[model samples]
Target: MYVGLVGCGLVGNKRARGLGSNHRLAAVADKDLTRAESLASQHSGCDYFADWQAVVGHPACEVIIVATTNDTLAEVATAAIDRNRPVLIEKPAARNSKEIEPLIEIAERNGVPVKVGFNHRFHPALIQARQIWDTGELGDLMYIRGRYGHGGRLGYEKEWRADPRIAGGGELLDQGVHLIDLSRWFAGEFADVDGYVNTYFWRMPVEDNAFMLLKTIAQQVAWLHVSCTEWKNLFSFEIFGRNGKLQIDGLGGSYGTERLTYYQMSPEMGPPATVISEYPESDDSWEMEFAYFIDCIQHGCEPQGNLKDAKAALRIVEALYEKHTSGKSVRL
Candidate 1:
């Protein structure tokens, strides 16, 4: 399938390499001509353009990938779907659903489908976690906990991510969106969600740290703590169940870098059961996610990370934003 790229920034470049494979990089565009050319030149037959509309409008490009900032994701996605092209937009979908919901409505009106990129669900470790849950190996889940963030924008005054208007926020929207989605995925739909966020350490406009409390539909509670100010850490998720607990220690790539371990009670009754661990050596979340989208496009199947999932995840963000600003609990 021929694909077009809208941005050549860090995530765009990384996905261009990882998602490139045998798929056609028919066209590419970026606000920066230099960056577009640099990335386009890496693969043959990839046309370059300065304006994103040009890339998405190219007749030869069958699919469009929107990797621009949160500000332009909705605009790019809406236009692409209008042209009857399927699209894969990077996370958060938009700064808020206000910016993206219309695109969802537009796609629905046109009978077209666009996918929001939530690559975490495609991770090997997450895949195993889901399998364990389905198999009842971990029994009924009790709680879900996660931590995901970085110190990439530590001292930036002019970074787009530091600006709430551009990035939405630091911990919650920027990185915590992944954990928020993961929390819902592991613990089921949230019965209630309430949280706190703060701006600290860095002199940025958005909150850099956040903590959330959630209860699943069954009243099983979970905690999601995320921070963008942490200088040297990564992402991880732990699931507590009736029988034991499962923890996944790596969120290194679009695919993960760890295994699923079960800490069950030992037969001796006084000690813990043997901790049995299972590892799926392959970590190709990027490839796996893109392949799933390809399948969705090819089979006319609804996407796993479709626009609907994107909206559901962003709803939590909206609630968090309302709560943070209003200093009152907001219902989802």
Candidate 2:
């Protein structure tokens, strides 16, 4: 199948690369023709256009991939849906819930499929962990906690990612949205939350550090912490339950880490819990998510990263920011 792509930034390029052999990058569009051309060169026979409208409306393209700035997401997404083309929009789906909730309606009315790019849902370790939980191997789940952080990147400036007005929130929206969505995705729908966000450096107009608490529908509480200020990195998840506890440690780090640990501790006459089994290293999450999107487009199926689920993640993000900026408790 021929797939059209928009945005020539980091995620866009990585996605195009991941698509490799199974799918063809039929067309690409970017505000900057140079970058668009550069991206087109990466694909043997792809066409590059300055305006995404042309890319989206191209007759040969069956799927439109919107990987641009958050602010421009809705416009491009709406256009793709309008053309009756299936769309796979990048994570967060939009700047806020106001932008996301409506897409569900638009998709239903148009009878075209829509997907958000929350690729972490396809992470192997995360998938295995979810399987463990579903099998009740961990017993009655109590709490889950994690952190996703890293040093800010240089390319942030080349794109609209550094600007709050265009990027939506800051690191909170960029990285925080990922952790928040994944936390809830594993824990269940969030029932309530409280959090804080701050941008201490990066010379950017968005938050650089963010910490959040999520109360899931199952009454499970999870802590999600993210910061671009960290010198190194940290990515780990701890699940506590009635049986004992299971600690899963990420190997590499956020965005690149490909390792996991599944050590469980059980009471043994009051002795300290011991490590049981640890998972071997795995694949890069970026590649995993990208491959999944292309597969969805090829076989004609709704991506596991559904629009409604992405909207749900964005809702939690919007609520956190609202509470941080307005000084109110977010009940939902």
The lDDT of each candidate is: 0.80, 0.77
In model 2, the runs with Cα more than 4 Å from the true position are 153-159, 244-246, 251-257, 267-287, 290-301
Candidate 1, backbone clash total:
3
lDDT by residue for model 2 (107-146), tens: 8898787878777666676777777778776677788888
* Candidate 1 least-lDDT 10 residues: 251-260
Candidate 1, residues 1-332, lDDT tens digits: the string is 88999999988886787574769788889999999999999989899989999997999988889999889999999999999898889998898877878988888888776777788898776787788778886677888888877766535656888888878766688788888777777776775778899988877778889888877667887788888667766677888887767777766543245666667754464655655454546556777888888888889888877777777778887888778888876666
- Candidate 1 regions exceeding 4 Å error are 253-257, 266-271, 274-283
Specify the highest-lDDT model's number: 1
Give the clashing residue pairs of candidate 1, or none: 265-273, 266-272, 266-273
Error of 2 at 177 (Å): 1.3
The root-mean-square deviation over C-alpha atoms between each candidate and the true structure, in angstroms, is: 2.4, 2.8
